[model samples]
Each structure stands twice: as structure tokens, then as C-alpha cells.
Target: MDYLSRTKRQYWIVLFVCFLIYNALIVGLWLLLHSLGSHFHVANDIALLICSVFGLLLMIVFSSIISKYLIEPLKAIWQLILHISPSGVAVPAPNIDSLKTGRELVANLAMQVYQLTAVAGQYGTKAADSELNNNFVANKLPLPLFILDSGETIIYANIAASDYIGTPVKDLTGKNFYMVMDMSFPSESTLDKWLKDVKANTATASMSWERVRLNVLDNHPTRLFDLAAFYNKDNPQNYETMLVLFDHTKQYSQDDQAVSFVALSVHELRTPLTLLRGYIEAFEEELGNEMNPDLKDFMQKMGATAQQLNAFVNNILNVARVDNDQLQLSLHEEKWDSIVESAITNIALRAKVRGIKLESHIEPGLPTVGVDRLSIYEVLNNLIDNAIKYSNDSKVIKIDAHLTHEGMIETTVQDFGVGISPNIMSNLFTKFYRDHRNRSQIGGTGLGLYLSKAIVSAHGGNIWVRSTLGQGSIFGFTLKPYTMLAEEIKNSDNKDIVRGAHGWIKNHSLYRR
Candidate 1:
């Protein structure tokens, strides 16, 4: 039998025997009292009173026995364990030697209990110190790191994290992560959105973002870095989320600022470019009758070249504006068809120069669109210009506008060009992005498509592409109707409507001159 069961059975047997003996003693006293009462002719009430007093005295003796044997030992053991210390400084051992009976048992038990407590306390202290040291090292490390609890609040941030974020440790702790970081990405997919998606749908996940820009609201310059996220759904370490940052601001901004400076310089060159174009047009008009055939062709070429330079300058400035987040949209209700016609007229000279014909189609009675005219014009120009640059021995570049069943204005620029590879689609709209293989042969600053995407997105539209190698490519976009987009903004929960699943599905494009 088990130890507890055997001990429990023994206890019952001892209690039953004691109960019988005590009852027998009571019977004996009652018989003795009755005999005395009869022999001495004592009153029945006096005999009963003597019996009651004896019963009360027996209870007091039983209580004294319990206190000395059971209660006293238990109290001494508790105090023994309490006074024992890991440092080996001992207190008086409860004076168990005074118990007189089983003094050896109580002393031995106290010694055993004290030994167990001393051992446990030492190991516990060591483990606690190790954990404390680990935390101290993490806080002092120069690498930026932080931990987040299940609530997405910042539970802990290292010193480096506080320095990188320009916030103090006390200020950062307990704050929601999304509130502190004003983040933007080259793609619509962000760190926070990915975190939510992983939490709801997966057991564990890891995600990283490259060239993640951290926009600072104060005097500090914006920071650029690569961010990595680590997560576990069931973690023993307690924290559910951890993020580490690798600051690459110096390297990334060095290249970007240098390019932005040169691009901004193009803003100054525009006036001279306009004068140059004006003079070229004047020469063509004044000398039209006197010039020979080859000379007239040369004049036409000069004007076309000037127009090309103007387009390049505009692209440079637009790209800089998009990078700096300075591009603002002034959307007006306008005729979608008229916009298309104007685009064709403006880009016709470039198409003629490239030996490519411009073609256009518009579904009749199309609704007006909410758009920024000049930026929309640039979007069209960039798309068609890209088609023209890559139109490998192709003839016609077709642009069409039609109202879709979804009540959005849809447009596509189709070209029989050296079709885009299945790869490189995701990065087509990234700023400063270029396909290295075509760098030598293709001439462009790679800003056209990126600038186009930013503008199209600002207007609450979507851009996408479909391509097959060695055949042709079609770049398409959609614009919500003016009334519908305005209504969406007014009714939007946060007063902003962002493209979620659809916007990130397509790549950005650029102009190649």
C-alpha cells in the first residue's frame, strides 16, 4: 500500500482504541460514583456534578498532549525553514531541546528542513543574478532592439533603441508601436500590416523590409534602415514580438541626397530649356521656305531634341518631389477623354521621332474623373514614353479609356515592345531602381514609373501591368469616378482610403528616353 494510505489506516486504528479506552474510563467513574452514592447515601445531584467536573479535567489533559506532541513540532519546523538563509547565517533553532520528549526527532527534522531550504535559496539566487546580468548587457548593447507584448505595446527597449528613435526609455515603454514610428515603404506592404497578418493566420512568422524610411516629426532628419521582425505564437520567453533595426541611413541617404541635389538642379535648367526650345521652333518657322530638304529635317530634329530635354528635366524634378514627399495633388473634375487627347498631342512628336504611331480609343459617354491634370498628363507621358523606348521594331502604341463595370475609369497603354520579363515586375516602380542588364543600352534616369505611381496613388487610383516576353506589354490603371472618390473620402473611417491588396500586386514603371 502507499505510504499515505498505510499511515492513514494506522491513525484510524489508534483513534478507535483510544476512543474505547476513554469510554471504558467514563463507565468506570460512573459505576464508582453510583456505588459511593449508594454506600454513603449521597444525593444523586452531587454525584452527577462530580462526574461532570472529571470530564472537563480530561479534555484539558488531552489538549495539553496535542500541543506538546503535534502543534509544537509543526510550529518549530516552520520557523526553522524561515530562519535558514543561503548565506549560512543561522537563527536559534526554536529551542526544540526543551520539548523533553522526542527532542532528538524535532532537532533532526529541523536540521533536515534547514539544509533543504539553504540549497534551494542558493540556486534561486544564482538564476536570478544570471537573468539580471543578461538584461544589463542587452540594455547596454549598441544595436537597436526592442520587445513587444501581445498587445503590440513596447514592453522593453534597449538604450540603442531609444537613441535611434530619439525617444527616452521611460517615454517609449508602454506606448503603442504604431504611434511612435511614422513609416513609409517603397511597397504598400508595411511592417505593422505584416505583423497583424501573421498573428491572425500563422503559428510563427518572420518578415523584413529594405530601405524602410522612418520619418521624424522633429528637428532630426528622417532615418533610413533595414528592419527585421521576429515573432512566436507560443514563446516561453514571454515577449511575443521582437524587432531589430540596422541603421543604413548614412549610406542610403548619401546616394539619395547626391542624386536629389543633381535632380533639383534640373529645376534651374528648365528656363534655359524653354528658351532653347522656343528658339528652335522660331528657326523652323522662319527658315521653312529657304532650307533644303536635309536642312529642314535637321531643324525638325533640333526641336524634337529640345522637347526630349524638357521631358527629361521634368522627370528629374518630379522624381525628387516624390522622394521628398513634397508632391501635392490639386484634383479637379475633368473630361477623361480630353485628357487622353491632350496627352497624345503632347507626346506625338516623340512617337514620330521613334517611328512609332500613336493610337487612342475612348468609350463614349465616359464619366468625368477626379484627377490632377498635369500629374495625370505625366503618368500618360511616362507610360507611353516607356512603350516607345522599348518598342522593338513595333509600329503602333495604343492607349484606351473605358468605364469598367465597377464604375471606375480604366485606361491601358499597350505596346508591341521588347516585353518585360516575368521577373522585375515587383520592383518596376521603385525609386532609383534600374535593371542593370539594360543600363548600357537603355537611356533613362529610372524615375518615370516611380513618379507616375505616386501621382496615380495620390488620386486614389490603382496601376498594374501585364506582359509576355517577345510579344507585347500592356500597362493598365483605374481611376474612381469623381463623385464616388469624393464620397469615399467623406465616408472613410480615418478620412483616408488606401489601396491594400490591389496596390501591391503590380510593379512601378519609369521613362526611358
Candidate 2:
């Protein structure tokens, strides 16, 4: 930094000296003009005007000369700047001998530049040697390693990476890391998401994650591994974003199987939940006209709680199915109002329990949508349940359904709650991601939005969120109208399923596919 300041100071000093000389010349011209005015008996006003014009022309010409001889020469002092002469740029031959002192200053500045270049060259050599040594060690390591750019595009991959990915490094290079590695993690923060966060937040940092599932792009066997990511370091050009993986499949597979067994055991809780729901339904039926407002609210709360728990159990099972490729959506024609009403009914009680009102409005005459009723029901359940949980002091949650101009049913659930922060919005729908601030205060498994996103996407629809801090959030999703889906099926290849889809984005989610 100081080098730039010193070069700049020398540059200005040259300009200042030339300026002083130019001023003296101007003063000499004024005196010469006064002498002519007196000797030729010309008007003093005319003499002054003539001097002013001459002075302007001289100033312009002088500026051109100084810029060419001095400015461009001095610019070489800082070679790192582009669009200008670099360190090796040739200074004009036959130095400006008329300005001997200026010529010497230029020589001094050039000598300093040469010294700077030599020092930089020595440093570059050392950095190169260090990087070569690091690369040698890295290639010998058992961990699968990859270097990616800011967009997660793989630039280099080691031999272990090729073995792990089931492809040669040459073939994997230049592909998007995410596309090449068809994998997922059970953790809140993923390796890719953490890479982005680190790039934005820090200069030098690394993180390690365990139990990262690695499913190679090709039809290769999936494996579990521990992962590490490094982003934006003061290293060689290609080492900016690097990732390493340690195989842990054999170790984690048994643990995963154990968890699955425990989950199957927990599934038995549904028997008690079924009987509990039956008792609540009996209460609702028997109470008849004798129940007061408070008793009605109590019954509603109990019923909603039981239903909510049932949904969670199903969600866990369905998520497992999704991971195993067993989850499938069988879309059928259903009235928009029918789907909204069923979902709202299930979640309305939960809202009432939290003292929050659900205001639902479906536009009249909207076309029926093509969606799997059970799957979409869960999507709505997750969304509205989230709204109820986060609607801090707000009392009302609005559910709006309308036929978009593009012939899709757009459903939105809005809440005036302590909304999400902008910094954390990108990973809101990713698996197991909960805002740390609310993670302790709130009771959740961090899977609701992720499950909701997966269900909606599997239905060939798009889901997204829009929120402002303290102003609350709006979670919206769009489903194709049954008529349109039928028409498209009749006209085109079935492969082009999702057309003109606004999959998701920052605030608008307006991207089309």
C-alpha cells in the first residue's frame, strides 16, 4: 500500500515543479506584452487580451508535453494496473534533456520500479515452490480432493477424486461440482452452502462435516464420507475453493441402519395417536350444543395436536421414501377450493391453539389443479404450521389462492411474524436448516420447509418464500391447472414436464425454465 502512495507522491511532485516553471513563463510573457504595449503605443486592454489567448494556448501545449514525457513514464512505477504501460513498458528514448532535473527524477522512479519487480519475482518464485510442494502432498493423500471456482465449477480434481467420483479427473474437470456429485447431507449446513457462506464472510477459513452422502454423477454406488471445504485463500490461482472427502461409508452405514430401526420402532406410536384422535372426535360429537367457546377451543387444540404429530410421522417416512427413490406423486384432477379447504381445516385448529386466525380466500371460478392430494396436503400443512409457529405477536395468517394469468393456481400463505433475516434466506428450504437464534427457542426438527419444497417440486410445481425482517413472510407455490397439463400431454413430448417454471430466487423467485 505504501508503495502506491510513494509512487503517487513522486508523480504529483513532478507535476507541481512543471507547474511552477509554467507560471514563471507566463509572468515573463506578461512583462514582454507590457513592454510591447508601451513601445507600439497600443491600448493596455488589447495587450492584456492578446496575452490571455497566448497564455491559454501555451498552457494547453505544455500540458500535452508534460503528459507524454512525464505522466506516462511515471505510470510504469505501478505495473499491476491494467489498461496502461506495465513494468517493462519502454520509456521514450533520448530523455528530455531540456528538463535535466525532471529526467533524473524519472530515472530514480524507474530504478525503484526495477527493485519492486525483482522483489515481486522472488516472492512469486517462493509462492510457486510452496504451492508445488502442497500439490505433491495433496495428490498423495487418501482423501478425494477437488478445486472449484466461485460458481462451484470444478477446475481441478486429484486422482482420489477421480476414483471417488467413478470418472477420470479429466472428465470431471469443468463440470459443476453439484452436478457431478449427486449427493445430499442430513446436516443443517451443507458443504456447498458453507462454501458460499465462507466466501462471503471470511478471507481464510475451513469447515469439516461428517456423514456427507456422495452419489457420483454416473450410475455409481453411493457412499458416505466426511467432508472439508476451504475457500478464498492467499494461495496459487487454482486453490481458491478446495474440497476434500474422507470415505466413511463402512462406519456410518451401520449407524444409519440402527437409526432406521429406531425410526421403525417409533412408528408404533401411531396406534396411540389413532386411539387419541378417536377419543377427540368422540368428544366433538358428544359435546353437541353443551360445549362453551373455551371447551370448543380446547377440543380443537387437542385434535390439531394429534393430527400434527401424525403428519410428522408421515413426513419422516415420506422423506425416507424420497431418499430411496420410492416416493412418487400420482397427480389427479381436483378442485382448487377442495385442496385448500382440506389443508386449511387440518391446520386451522393449530392456528386457533396459538391464538392466530387463518384467513383463507380462494378466487372464484379458478380451474382445478393437477396435484397429488395427499402430498400437496402435507406441503400446505408444513407451510401453514410454520406460519403458526413463527407468527409471534401477529394474530392473523392469510391463505390466498388465485388463478395466475399464466394458467396456474398460485397459493400463498402469509404471516406477520418475526420474519427471516436476509443473510439466512438462501438456505431456508435446504434440509435441516434452522435459524440458530430461534433453533433453541422454537421446537422443530428443521425439516418442514425442506420436506415442503421436495413435495411441491415432485408435483412438477415450484415453491418459494418472500419475507422482510419484522414485516413477516409470504410462502407461495404454483400448481399447473389440470386442463393445461392435459393439453400439454396431448401436444408435446412428456419429457418437457416443467415449462416456464419460476423454480426459486432471492426475493422474487422469477426464474423461468
Candidate 3:
């Protein structure tokens, strides 16, 4: 039996028995008085009858009045006991003077009960207010909090709980927790068994749980959070589970930014160093026979050191740009034939300067390709420049442009320069991943290819290299088929006109997105 329910039943039974005893006493006193009146014959028969009737009526009226006053307060007490909400209700107590002589003690007892009830109500109100304030503060706290009863039903949750589940607090309550995205718990039997074991094993036992991934918001990829459950130290009847989110997305983004910055910066530095290296080599060649032979060797070594430094700077800068997502590709509509011609024309001087011949073949009437003009220009420059740098003197470097059946515009840069090694091909797009096979002769920052790939990707294109260690390399990328922005706007307007029945689904997508 429930303790509080059993206590209430006992109270009511005791009150009923007291009422019966008091009524019985009143009836017994009346009967005794009547018997005395009949036997003593204090007056004639008619007088006796009148006096007895009067006495009986008076006694009945007084008993009824006393019973009414006393029962009213007792009934109020019973109601107060039954009410769960702690609203103030004054117990209608009896005035001691209004009670019959024999009922004065009962009235006094009733007044004392009323006073005790008032004091209890005051304390209860203070405690409830304190608890409410604590709950308000707890709701705003960062930690995910939940309260559950022995039946495993969620009773309360804080604001962090709403965030963790990706819903408002009101909507979350009464819903089965496991139904929410990415939250899980042990089976009921398993949890109960574990609790039993923990209670049996030691003074205290705790185990760290694994991290759980949950997509707390729509369209976002899953993120990790640490979850833990423990026994409530102050209340053994309850258990609490807490969750903490450790955001690692920003950490990864920062690392990428650092790499991209290093790549771009190094590439920028190399351009100046390359110019310096060329001057140094030219001076050394002119002064070679006139200066001491040993001095000539020292100058050659210094020039070589400068060349290597320039290459190192370029590779770091290119890789950094890729990682940081800072590689910008300015997209625009441009004729494929014209863009190809301009790209080749710009790099033609560099190829000629390097004693490498330049060749170009562009398919006529190829539809305009939407691409970042500046980024594509750099891509062409880097590929052609690298070809000239590594090619045997006066070797040919070819550039080609065409359209694919899949509505893609493709561009390729073919170079006969000492080709990329199979082992180093995968690392070519990586920052500062130099091909050490040509380490003895070639010099570059190794960032050009990395940056080129990153730029191509930003323009919604793909880039790859085809090569063998000693043959040549072909670097190519494919851009998406171009469509005018005007056409896109036209399609959007048509979608608006096709509303009504289909509008509902379209509206959902628009709002959801």
C-alpha cells in the first residue's frame, strides 16, 4: 500500500469513530433526562410533557449546531489533505464560545489544527519557490540535463537538452527519447542489471562511455558528443545522464587554412627568387673564365641554393591555398576557343624563353564554358610553365581544348618534361610533395600543381595528371557545361506560376531549405 494513502484512510476512520462516540453520548444524556422527568414528576403530567418536549428540542438544536461547526472544519482538513496544489485555503474553525459546553474542547483542538496547517503551508510555499528558481537557472545552463522517474519516463529537461535533440523543450517532453535522431540507451533489462550490479559491487562504481554522433540539426552532417550516466548522489531513487559537445569542425578548418596560406605565400615568394636566380646564373656564366676557378664554383653553388629556395617557397604557398579554401576561381561566361587561345598566348613567351616549343589545338565552335577566368589562366600558366621548366631544351609542349558528350568542356596541358614518377604521382597534388627522383636537377616550390588542382575544383571542375617516370605528363581538367544566368531566372519564374496542388511540396522544400 502507498504510505500517504494509507495514512489518509486511517485519519478519516478515526474522525468517523470520534463523531459516533460524541453522538452516542448526546443521545444517552437525553434518554437519562427523560427517564428522570418521568420518575421524579417535577410537575403535573401536562407540565412534565411540555418541559420534556422543550428540553429535548433545545438539546437537539444545540447538538446539531455543534456537529455542523465541527464537521465543517474536519471536512476542510480532509480536502486540504487531498489537494496536490499548495494554494492557500483557510480551515473554517469553530468559535469556542459558540460551541456547546461539552464541545468546547473539540473547538480548541480544531483551532490548533488550523494553526499547524497554516505554518506547513508557509514552509511548503517557500520550498516550492526555491525549487522553481533553481529549475530556471538549470534550464539555461550549458550542460544537457534530464530527469527520469523509476518508470523510465522523462519528467524534466533543461534548455541544453532541447539543443541536443534539435527541438523545443515543450515538444521534447512525453516523446520517447530513443526516437530522436542519434540518441541511444541500453536496453531496460541491461540498464536494470547494471544498476543492480553497481549497487552490489563497491561503495561507488563509474565507467566512461563512448562518444556518440548525432545530427542535431537538419541538413548538417553528424557531430560528436560525450554522454554519461550516473546515480544521483543525494537521491538514490533517481539516475542522471549528461551530454557534452566538443566541436572539432573549427579545428580542422583552421588546419586547412594554415596549409593554404603557406602554399600561396611560398608561391608568391618564389616568383621574386626565380628572377633573382636567373640574374645570378647569368652573372656567374659571364664571369666564369675571368674570375678564379674556385670562385666560379662558389657562385654556381650559391645560384643553385637560391633556385632551390625559390622552388621550396612556391610549393608551400600552393598547398596552403588549397587547404585554407582561399583559392578563388572567378567564374564567368567565355568562349572555349577564345579562352584557350588567350591562355596559350600568355604562356607562349615563357615557353620560348625556356627554349621549349609551344603547340595548341582547340576544337572550333565548342560552346562557351563557365569557369573562373583568372584561376583558369593560372592553371594554364602553371602547367605550361612547369612543362617548359622540365622539358629537354627546345622540346614541344601541347595544349588542347575540346567538348565531351557529357556536356563537359575539357582542357589538357601535355608536357615532354622529365615525366612524374608513378610513386610520386599521388603526392603531386599535396603541398611541398616534391618528386625527389628529379631532385638532382629540377627546382620548384612543388605548389603549382597543388594550387592548380585546388583552383580547378573551386570552379566545379576536376583535374588529374597522366604520366610515367621518364615519359611526359598530361594535366587535364573538365568544367561543367555552361548555362546563362538569364535562363536560370526564367526557369525560376515558371516554377512560381505552377502553384496550387504542387505548391505545397514546393513550399516545404523552400522553407525546409
Candidate 4:
């Protein structure tokens, strides 16, 4: 197995054979000279001296020839082995055909060694890859797996695959996949199309799928998987498809149970909220004629609580609508600044009642964003509402809007009231996530910020928050600007519908809307 042990043994055998021949020839010459030269002593002595010198010179010449032809090539091979990296492999230099002798056998042997070295290097790489893949399949994977080649042949299957196939993988391999497994592969599906496209353009694609299945071990539970396949993204060869699967039967049952629970709970809560609002309205109406001032104030507070409950129910409905894709945007181009001013006016009375100051810092030349005027107004209203609710008396809530370099209008609502903790920042945009670490004294359904973030994102923009506890918070969002096409313009009369009131710049509208 070791280079020196094997090569040195070969060199010793060759040297031994050469030594035997040299000894035999020397003995034969000595015997012949001893028998023929006894009669001519002087002449034989001179001839014997010449023969000894000639034999010595000849031994030196033969040794040099052997080193050049046999020993040197082996030494070069040994050097090549030493140069190999930890992987036990190297890319051999091009075959030195110039070193080859005219002898046919020598030339043939040299060519074979060159070819074998090339093959050996490739084998080393494949061996490493095979070991890694086997480890990954046995330890890392939680589900059964198989990789298919372009011809739909099973190229690699893991231990899970063997367990799922109800037989050892070796038995299933080389068997036409469709013949062994009674399943249908759609010819018109994305998988087939991807294969064709890859062949045509030599580009990779991820395949879409609805379902897949596998046979578990005999007497074991059979498995059905929802699956998707993608071309091997990392490899340039793209010779295989990576199949991902999930147990859909379990997931489907869980979804069914969740739906039933939500349906029952929503029904139960709706009845109580409806009754509370009805009673509050009746009490408020009765309070209009009440003589007790304390009772009247209590009734007014009850009315406000009832109104908050109503808003909570409305938020739930809106979220449900969005989840079901039933929420429609009545998009129109409207004055950007005018919408902000209108929202400010609408909330001015509420802000004053709460003893909070509302202010705007609009950029001098901010462009309009495409949005449903009412939806954008709702987003601003929630931020301002929360600011006023959490702030102490005389705290200022500043709303700023400006045009960004990428043509988006960036709007931020800054509140220098109680800030949020970093741990809770991630959950702020999630539905019904209340930051109860502080500001527990304030009231909300916790849906306001969540709904506002969703609405802004749905408009092809992003919303984010920056905050440090005990410092302040900045709730910011970006929106793409809306531009009216030349053909959309009619007379100023028609333009009034798109433009906001009081010379307000048109904010946003969709092209097709």
C-alpha cells in the first residue's frame, strides 16, 4: 500500500537479477581464460588485465543506462506522490511523450500509467463525495428522500428511502422508476417543462408539485407527502432534481381542527360585543335626560369603552377580510398633503381631549404616493391615536413626510413618550402583540400597529420601527410615488375627482384603477 515499500521491492528484484547475470558471466570468462591461457602466460596476463578493466567500465555504463531508463522514471513518480495534498490526489502534469523511447512496449506502458493517474484522481473525489452524502442522508434528514436524474432514473436514495420503499434501495435501483412504483408523473407539469427548458436553454428551474407518496416498511404506517422538486441549484451539471416532502395528512388534520375552533370562538365573542354596544348606546341616550352629573359622566365613559370594543371587532373583521383576499383597495390619485391635513383635522378634537399636541413637518416638495386615500388616512390615524393615548399632557406627536432618492415618499410618526424595548420590537408588527412591559395603563386592541404595517406593505412599501426604552420611538413607512399619465388628463373638471380639496397635490392611484 505504501509507495516506498512496493517500489523499493521492485527495484531490489531488478538489481538482484542484474547481479546474478554479472556473477555468472564473470565466472564463465574466468574459467575459459584459465583453461586456454595456461600455455601463454605473459600474453594471457596482459589480456586478463585488459578484460578486467573493460568489464569494470562496462558495469559503470550499464548502471548509468539502467538509472536513466528505469530508476529515473520511478523517482519522478515518487516525487509526484509526495506533491499530492491531504486529499491523496493531484492533477498530474501532461504526459512527457518526449521521454518515451522508440521501443513499442515502453511507449505503451508509459501511456497506460498516464491514463491511470488521471482516473485515480477522479476516483478520489467521487469517493469523498459519496461518503459525505451517505452521512447527510443517514443523520441529517428527517423524511424519506430520493434524487432523480434527467431520465427520471433514481440516482441517489437515502436510508429513509429504503425504509419507505418497503425494500432495500439496491433492489429498487436500475429498475425503471414508473414500472416499480405505481405512480403517475404529469407530462405537462412544471417538472417536465423545467427539464425541457433546461435542455433548451441550459438554465435551472424550481419545479412546482401538488403531491407525492411512499410505501413504508411492511406492517408500518404508509406515508403520503406533499412535495416540490428543484434542479440542483449548486451544481452546473444540473443532472439531478432535489425533492422536498412534507407529511400532508397530519398538516391537513391540524388545519381542519384550527378552523373549527376559530369559527366557534368568533361566533361566541360576536354575540357579547353586539349586546354590550347596544346597551351602551341605550344608556348614552338615557343619560341625555339624567339629572345626576356623576351618573352622566359615568355613562359617557361607558360609551367610549363601548366604542373601543366596536373598533376592536372592526379590526378583527378587516384582518379576516385581508386573510381571505376579500379586502379591496379603492385606489385613486388624491392630494398627498391634503390627506395628511384632513387626518390631522379629524383627530384634532381627540388630541385636545387627551391633552396632546398634533403637528406636521411635511417636506417642501414631497411627491404623491399611489394609495387608497381612506386606507392611507387610517394608517396615519392609528399612529397619531396611539401617540396621544400614551403621551403625558403637552407631549408633541410630529408627523413628517419627504421624498426619498428612490422615488418613495417616506413618512414617519415620532412620539417622544414611553419607548419600546428591543426584545418586543420584533413582535410590534404582529397581530395582537401588546407591549405590556410598560404602558399597560394605556388601552388598545393591539391590532392598530399590526393593521397599519400590513396596509403600508400591501401598497408595495415597507414599514419599520426604531425605538429605545425610556427614550422615544419612530414609526416610519415608505410608499411609491404615483404619477398621472398624459392620456389620463381630461379637463380640470374631471381632474377634481383625482385631486384632493383645497389645492392639495394628488397623492396616489394605480394605472388600471
lDDT values of the candidates?
0.76, 0.74, 0.59, 0.63
Comparison by lDDT, 2 against 3, better one? 2
Report how far off residue 319 is in candidate 3 (Å).
2.5
Per-residue accuracy of model 4 over 311-382 as CA lDDT, tens digit each: 455567557656656566545555577778777876675665555678898887676566766567678878
- The per-prediction tally of clashing pairs is 4, 0, 17, 4
Q: After best superposition, candidate 4 residue 122: deviation in angstroms? A: 65
| Candidate 3 lDDT over residue span 215-267, tens digit each | 45566655554455554433333333222334444554565466656656666
Model 3 lDDT, full chain set: 0.59
Q: Which stretches of candidate 2 lie over 4 Å from their true place?
A: 1-263, 283-299, 487-513
Best candidate, lDDT-wise? Answer: 1
- lDDT for 185 in candidate 2 is 87
- Candidate 2 Cα deviation (angstroms), residue 396: 0.5
- Looking at model 1, residue 344 earns an lDDT score of 83
Give residue 143's error in model 1 in angstroms: 35
Task: Please identify model 3 stretches exceeding 4 Å from their true place.
Answer: 1-135, 138-140, 143-318, 324-330, 405-407, 420-432, 457-471, 484-513
Candidate 1, which segments miss by more than 4 Å at Cα? 1-264, 487-513
Q: What TM-score against the true fold does each predicted structure earn?
A: 0.45, 0.44, 0.39, 0.39
Off by over 4 Å in 4: 1-310, 392-394, 484-513
Instruction: List, residue by residue over 71-185, the lDDT tens digit for candidate 2.
Output: 5544433432221134446454323234323445544555454445435543553234233333434455578988887667887787788887788877887899888887788
Predictions: Cα RMSD each: 20.6, 19.7, 24.0, 15.6
